[model samples]
Target chain A: MAQEHTVKSYDEELNQLRSMISRMGGLAEAQLTGAIEALTERNAEKAQRIIAADRSLDILEQEIESQAIQMIALRSPMADDLREIVAAIKISSTLERIADYAKNVAKRSIVLNQSEHVKPAVLIPQMVELTKVMLKDALDAYIDRDAQKTIMVWESDKGVDELYNSLFRELLTYMMENPRLITPCTHILFIAKNIERIGDHVTNLAEIVYYQVKGETLDMNRPKSDDTSFAVVPPPANT
Target chain B: MAQEHTVKSYDEELNQLRSMISRMGGLAEAQLTGAIEALTERNAEKAQRIIAADRSLDILEQEIESQAIQMIALRSPMADDLREIVAAIKISSTLERIADYAKNVAKRSIVLNQSEHVKPAVLIPQMVELTKVMLKDALDAYIDRDAQKTIMVWESDKGVDELYNSLFRELLTYMMENPRLITPCTHILFIAKNIERIGDHVTNLAEIVYYQVKGETLDMNRPKSDDTSFAVVPPPANT
Candidate 1:
């Protein structure tokens, strides 16, 4: 009966950790969306708010990381519990990076605010929405231990990439057509690139989920042209 | 006598691991230089070679990571030895990322090969050289455990960032002045951004060194705005 109670407590701690991470993920996703919105609407205050908000996420990251170390040292977990803790570490790091990228977007948006709006910012917000959805879904997959949903999020990244490529081409055309518009357009380009990277981080989270569930490595490298599906390739032959 | 023998063996392993990481760092630095040269010269074959060269670095990264893990598992090191292993893991990841950014530069060069040269690729090669020196110096600090030298490299990153900003503005102007130059100019912009990111990764390595030597956290997220001094930031007050 005592062993059963200890197991239950471990499970509860694990769940709480996951919940904390998911909350952090939601905050980061909102930051990305708000940053892009601020850029499009030329809302400097909103952009500043996003930048300031990152400090709390940074604090949360450090807190969770220490908590994880404490858990590892105290519980000495193995198997699934071990995997869960490791996943939490990786996910926290990735989310911190995502928040950093969003902060970059907001910073550039502040720079571009002084200049005229170059384009409608149509494709960027759409792309941001898609990436936000991917981020949400990936975190949900982790919380629910839904491997299939994780795979779906991984596949969704390709769509985000395609959108970014198209946006890049369009922005290039804009800069080409009007020499005066280069500064603001280039700032917009960075904003778009940051969103695309957020998508990449979401894909990374998905791969971590796959690894924890399967006890196998997943290829998180950029896709090669020869690979038809973006599915995680198995561990290399030598390994 | 047994303790002395074990110490000797541990010293040997530590020396070997340090040597390997330094060698890997040198290769990554050379790749950065080669990638930038390929961009400036618009050498498609050279760019192709740089792309191919990254595979070896990837293999080396994996080898170093596994060796570090093995050392940790076998020796159960404490204090500096443990910190050294952890730094190895972080440094290898940063080096791999630097190589990836280099490959991105090479890939952009490949696309720019067929187009007319945009702006003589002047600022970019300089930025790349500065980043290479930073990477080299950071590794030197790691091998020697020279916290002072590591701080210098960390400071140098701001110069690289300034150069990147200037290049971004220059390229933006070029694209705006000549709409026909948009395609190739955008490629150059990406190359510049990649080099700038490489510089950031090198700074990250330096930060790891600072942590390893001083056992204190450095604020890596702070914007590098005219700061030249290194002071150890205390952990959060709440913690």
Candidate 2:
């Protein structure tokens, strides 16, 4: 808890806040991995567990908010210190959202496992693996406060968006070909979209870290590769 | 800008921040309405205009962020004033997201209007109307610093969720029944989902406003009516 700062108490409080955020990040990482495992293995029980565990994330968020508010009141953090506290608040909320998305994926898994298992659930596992790696790297970068690492993590989100776009088109094609697949396909779409969005939130953390460590927005244009909004899927008439 | 407090400069800074937020909120409200009107009138030109205007929201968000950081650095705001500045930052980001969703809806509308309009865009208009009212009230509550009004706005978001759930099922059914309709229906689903999320962001604003005014989490256990995660849509097998 002791840093190269004059005020030992302020350093300790910030350290406590850091550790809390790390714990929350660890929980979020576990949930992302756990939900995907639940989906891949069709373990409804595991999915249920992940869903149940989300309450902890919510509780942790409240704790972070309380601590951050208390720190602001007591320490009167300015400039970088204020930004640091705000980052914790924002990052915790992002982690909580990531946890919620993981829960949604798990819930979808419960329903997916019960229905006809026609789709191989192929791309999603790959996406889950990729996203988990990204999530891990993003958190690690945050803790290390390595601006370059954060920038790298931020760039990697484009890969997530591209993967999501491909999966989106693939699922829609299946739905258009086989109406029976629409219900399952739609759920899968949401799950994949959830993962994609989780990637976006992780990118947000990376940006916050970048801004905190370096006093500037990462990149002005922010090359977002999300093509989902275009709504340009072909009709698949030949099918 | 003039406050009864001794810090005249601080009061003016806070006032400037508030006006910036209000301007951003106004832009967001117009975007939501413009997107819907674009859909109803089947006007692609109007949708394009809405899409172009999103850059303004993005610009405003950055200004709000810079101003907030500068204020924290200069004023060393404490307690309520700190909360007030933080509220402006959070609310502006939410407004930015709402604006983005509206742009997405407009983008989808351009594609949807290009395709067949078999579904008549039924519940969407009602949902859009409902969300617009919630957003408006949420902004009003923020300006007034009325916790009661904020809570009312927060509770009203359940209606948006209910409407979204109903719209989700309807669009899915349409996609299942008409194979050719899959493309447009999917786009509309995203648009409706976008509007639903905007409502959630507005609820977030209400929560922040309540916290700023009351210095507590508003009543806890927010009553969310969203059951989309339940995944009990009967598989739409009969369609």
Candidate 3:
């Protein structure tokens, strides 16, 4: 009876851990959504709320970390259970990072609101919207232990990178054409970069989910399309 | 006698994990140093080498993670032993991320080499130098289990952030004054941001070290002064 009780309790603990991760994923999604809305609406006040709300995600991550540690020490779970605990820790950390990126975007949006709107800023929301879907799907993959879904999210990141590449070029050209656009455009550049980074983290989540479910590493050389590093736009001929 | 052998084997496993982490840290440091050298020298070939070398760090991180997990499951390590394994996994992942940033800087440096040198590029090497010192100290703190050293590294991150802020302003001013410098300056800007982020990750390593040694969380509200998010550099008045 005691053994059965312990087994039941351990199962409950694992369930609790999953639910906590689910809650974190939901919070991160909301934060990203709020940040995007704030950017699109140029609502600094809402952005401020998103920035402050990031603390909750941070605190939750710490809690999850401790819980996983405690479970590992006491339960001494083997094989798949161990993988699940490790995945929980990694996923929570990735979600916290996602929230950090969202908070950074929120912070940048506040600064961006103070300057004249750059037209390329509109493209960021579309990129972020795609990322948001991937984030949701990645979390769903984790919840369902669906490796196929994780692979789908994994392939989706290339699309986000392609968007970021174009956005990078458009913003650079915009700043070059209008020197007055430089200040605001720089913030836009970072905001887009932050979203792109969030997409990267979401891809990381997909990898984690796949690893936990399949006990295998995803191909390290995933499709990568962000080529802004090599991009060079010559100065306008008149400049 | 069997119990004694088991204990000895577990200790050896733990020691192996520590040594692997140290090696990973050393590789990350070397990668960062090479990246900075490549940037300062505008040596595209050297930058290409650093980019390729990042793969080794990724492989090392994966090995460390699996070794740590194996130790946990096979040994069912308790208390400090478990904490050490967990710390190894987290630290290795952080080092992999540090390497990723170095590779990114290397990629940009290749692009940067093709452009006319921007004067502000000189400041980036200085910033990276400060960050490299912090990385070494943070790793030392982990190996020595020295909370004091971790605290020092934690405090030093602010210096990196300050340098980054100044660099951000200077680059903006340079780009504003000379539109021709925009492309290279943007790469320089990202290189600085990458280094600043490395400093942030070093701070994270410090916290992890402190937690591993003291079995308590550091105050999450460590000093952070990266204010570039709020910064605004208007175009030169004549522009």
Q: Who wins the lDDT comparison?
A: 3
Candidates in descending TM-score order:
3, 2, 1
Per-model TM against the reference: 0.84, 0.90, 0.95
Fnat of the models, one by one?
Answer: 0.20, 0.43, 0.62
* Per-residue C-alpha lDDT of model 1 across residues A36-111, encoded as one tens digit per residue: 8888888999989998999988888877765665566457666677667767767888899999999888888777
TM-score quality measure for candidate 3: 0.95
DockQ of 3: 0.66
B128-205, model 2: which lDDT tens digit per residue?
898888888888988888899998888888998998888888777888777788888888888888888888888998
Of all true interface contacts, what fraction is found in model 3?
A: 0.62
Of all true interface contacts, what fraction is found in model 1?
0.20
The top-ranked prediction according to TM-score is: 3
Candidate 3, clashing residue pairs? none
In model 1, the Cα lDDT at residue A237 comes to 31
Off by over 4 Å in 1: A1-16, A69-79, A219-239, B1-16, B59-76, B219-239
lDDT of each: 0.76, 0.85, 0.90
Model 1 steric clash pairs: A179-B176
Best of the two (1, 2) by lDDT = 2
What is the CA-based DockQ of model 1?
Answer: 0.19
TM-score of B-chain for each predicted structure, in order? 0.87, 0.93, 0.95
